[model samples]
Target: MTRSAPRSQAAELELPGLVRDRVREGRAKAAATRARRHAEAEIAEESPVARVLVDVPLAHLDRPFDYAVPVAMAADARPGVRVKVRFAGQDVDGFLLARTTQTTHQGRLQPLRRVVSAEPVLSPKIADLAAEVAERYAGTRADVLRLAVPPRHATTEKEPSPPAGPAEPWTVSVAASAWAGHDPAEAYLHHLADGGSPRAVWQAAAGSVWPLLLAHAVAATAASGRGALVVVPDGKDVARLDAALRQVLGEGRHVALTADAGPARRYRDFLAVSRGAVKVAVGTRAAAFAPVHDLGLVALWDDGDDALAEPRAPYPHAREVLLLRAEREGAAALVGGFARTVEADHLVRAGWAHQIRPTRALARERLTVAIAGASDFDLERDPFARVSRVPREAHETIRAGVATGPVLLQTPRRGYAAALACETCRAPARCGACRGPLHLTGATTPPECGWCGRVEEAWTCAACGGRGLRAPVLGDARTAEELGRIFPGVPVVTSSGERVRASVPDRPAIVVATPGAEPVAERGYAAVLLLDTWLLLGRPDLRTDEEALRRWSNAVGLVRPGGRALAVGDPALPALQALLRWDQPGFARREAEARAEAHLPPASRLATITGEAGAVDDALTLLALPAGGEVLGPVPHEGGRDSEEWRAVVRAPRAHATALSSALGELQRVRSARKLDPVRVQVDPPSL
Candidate 1:
């Protein structure tokens, strides 16, 4: 029995061992195959050292690293092309910056994993600009590149870009009449047309003809066989500018690059610009980095709009990017807006850019502005003029204007009742569950928590223990509802948030809109009513007054030449006076002087460092401040989810800005090296 063991049982016992042996052999063969291929790959002899900028966001690894390029990838591994390289034992995406014969790296260099694309998306100009922006903002280069270049779409990349062609003669003549009162503007266009770079800060007159004015400048630049780029605030402005460009320059001469165009279209437009297939690029914030060939002019509208600021690490402003490009590329620059910003005024005062503004008489003829509470008649007619959101004078103006054409009512907020307070005690109503402010979405809707989105069926005032609620502030929805009742039989249109209307028919209608969401009228608005002016002026930010005046001027600038604008605010306020006199440049000059005297920004550089308490402490400890640099806080920061988070502000004079940014960047590198928690470093944040 022992000699004749069961044959079936013996075969089954050997199956497990046989399977294990086969798997081991297969793995070993695969490993050997990879090793043999790596050893056999040929390295390029000439310019073998390829400098690659890895996509890692860590501050410590921000600079380009040298890697050996294999012969197979040498042709496709051109500068500005995308590639993958071994970085810290992991294959990471990178941009090939350059190639050289020598090597600064003493250790053996690793070969590139593979070439991602042969198409050169990152232009040398854009690469340098990204580096400058990162250094200026105290951010890692990779972070800036993320904003500079859109993600690659393989399908779009595979499509061949149209061949570069001769510049087309503009179809429509430059509308020189649009700049009739602006002598400097006319001269600026002529200079651009003659291949001269001139920087100017243009103050647009009241009307919707600004697009045409910009088109004239862009066309003037294109006539010199140079490219132009225009950055606006949002997609609406993009559409308007795109239409104007086509009308002036003809079809296929320009492209609109925007996030709203979908990733594929955006990437396709970007490639078209990079390949010199289009000479002009117009879009929102990201258009600041459009790789226009032979860049000649960089212009931006409404630079003060919050939408122009990048809401990411580094937080570069579109205006700053254009300024940088204009300086680096020897290109003309135009910072144009209906209302001037202190930064733009600073450029004029510094003699870096000239101001192009209409004469006082011209401005007054084009616009008619008044403050609701300024006149004695207003106070007499409505005793509640000081407290009423819509004073009697504004109401009357709206009523009379609606009879002629569309009337635009600009509100500060967007919801029905953005904030609610107890009627009896005047205490703000809050949700018991979240302690968040209560608001109403509609007249019949119950109160709900703004932060948590929880309906508060039984909300109470914490300060006064009252259940009753009243809206201290009215939003666009509520204003539209009230206007409907006031002007019976008149159609009421509302525009705000995601439901914003681009344009309204030139008819007898009342259009209520939030700031930045006002619709363009076909024949221009007959009247512009800026309601609740105090809400804008009451913000706690440092730019409150400047921003408030900017908003009011933008609204008032929409009125027809003989039309009127009435704002509900104190007449004595500087912002209101500026609106009445149509003197944004004067107001901006005063604001710049005030900020310089107070050592606040535009006169100085400010960097905000925010993170967890311990992380902030660590950064501050590692920071080596430049001479005259100062730190403001380690105050509790409300930006993060953790209550223990803190914020510190580092400030320096304009002369020492670079040094301060360098020091902050070094400290960030140290934190990264130590593997500490990440902290945000934002230089010149739009708000402080």
Candidate 2:
């Protein structure tokens, strides 16, 4: 699984209907009450409100512990304030989610030493959501809150300057006059500012440069006298969105919320949002909590990306955050993306938002194709069935495309050299010291395994007597090497990460890139050799087909009309037919139906129970009931002799997920009474 990097910043807050009349009355009454109580004792106010900070270290036991509220700073101790409180005799940070006349304290309570900041960090909504996330993920509230609210950025402070970024163009799906029809994206922008009440989601396609789309929407919403929040996938997306927002919304009117900003800068942005200095909030995942006076709409881009899922404790996702906030605050939510998730599709199916999309037929006019597969079409098929290698038919396409422009080779892995096998034996050579797969570093050097730091000497081929080896599972380097050899006179540029080509203009050269790393051709690629299509299409996971289609669509989108795109695969499959006809939307609809029939994700919520084989069995046996559905897998682990973990899956209606989750939490609590917590609950996991 792709573990996404943390965003620059994000936060959660729940604002009560705090009004002017209430603040004044509450303050005056609190002040008078404090004065009367202080007259007699310096020891302690017998029943003073102690703003206790508690974290749910354990999911079922997510209750706040008792703490003392010192008298000197009573007025400043508002809910959402972080303070140093002594818990278990050690000072720990806690957010005051709420205050009450009492706490269930049998032991003596410790007084809060100092309020961390006068500014409020925890919103009541976020605080509640933090607890909710804990319950759902079977994790401690404290753990969830730690990720939801990092310690340092929670404080109120100002910074000298904002961070800088590289000049990478945002990913955008340029459409024709779908804009001539009033440009819902642009109109949505206008309504954001004219808001009397808040709520709405601006649905869009994948690769639509949503940061820019959202910035426009926010600026429009702000212009209409409402605040808007734009949440995207990562820091890179944040930069593009932030820049676009500043350009359109104007600098002073907007604030960027991301973890990448320095502590002081983040605090400043938070304060600006809290104080309503910024009407348009543009940020990464954490920016969902836009502290605006009156929210207009909450826009989340690429809602499907795992980056939207919080990684800390509770593992709450941004889509849920946006949903809850939108529901509670009446803010419009626009969960836009280039590619639609089944969850997103469900939202449209449920009438949450009208499903939006780019016209593929129109898109196809600009798209061209050249497909080769395992049929009469294939000239030279791979022995191992890897598509990325240079097959003879691929050679023909490349030669033709190269004469006009560059040829692109897309592979799965990125490396100089990926696989190594004994030349004589053909079996994967291993280091005797560590049992790890060995790599051949140099002709004279010993083979080493990366896993155990183990090296092997006199390590001859197991199958044959050959001491040397060859790369079996080909990588970008191998492809580049072969391409270099085939077209020796041509300049071969390899793109992977930071040094990748910004744009792939029309050029007579071979560009080799790993998936997701392929740059757009400046003019256009003469041909795209989609190698290893089967490896991508045939993954064991349910998403294999959907994911493979996405890869194909993205590549096709970059191809110029009448340009060549040869996808080498089992042409007999319908996926190939769909590609031949450019029928992505049709294919997606069909795949969704199949998944629904199979009771898979997007159709039913999935709760995966994984642990040691024995532990999983015991836990599954204990889960007697799931409110909305049936239990699915206590299935065996696939691949490898040492794969000891087994899994049990629970599939329930999307509506029943919470109740089922709650039941699991309750079961966990009951089990805790009998034994330690055994099963873990992960909701809407990226994959099973």
Candidate 1 residue-wise lDDT, 1-688, digit = tens: 4586598656646679888677678889999999767653778887998999999989889999999988878888899999999999899999999989988899888998888999988999999999999888888889988988899999999898775444446522345666777746777887898899999999988874788789889989888889999999999999989888777777778899999999999999999998888878999998999999999999999999999999988889999999999999999999999999999999999999998988777787887887876553456654444544576787799889989999999989998998888887877787888788888999999999999999988776778777888888888899889889989999999999999899999999999999888898988999998888878988889999999989888887888877888887778899899888888999999999999998888999999999888889888889999999999988888655457779999899999989988888888888888999888999999998
Question: Each candidate's lDDT (Cα)?
Answer: 0.87, 0.64
| Model 1, global lDDT | 0.87
Write the residue-wise lDDT of candidate 2 on 445-556 in tens digits: 5657868866766677656678776666566766777788898787677777565664656778888877666776756677777777776765787677766766665555
- For all predicted structures, in order, the TM-scores are 0.91, 0.78
Candidate of highest TM-score: 1
Model 1 lDDT, residue 417, Cα = 90
Best by lDDT: 1
Write down the TM-score for model 2: 0.78
Off by over 4 Å in 1: 1-40, 163-173, 374-389, 453-468, 639-642
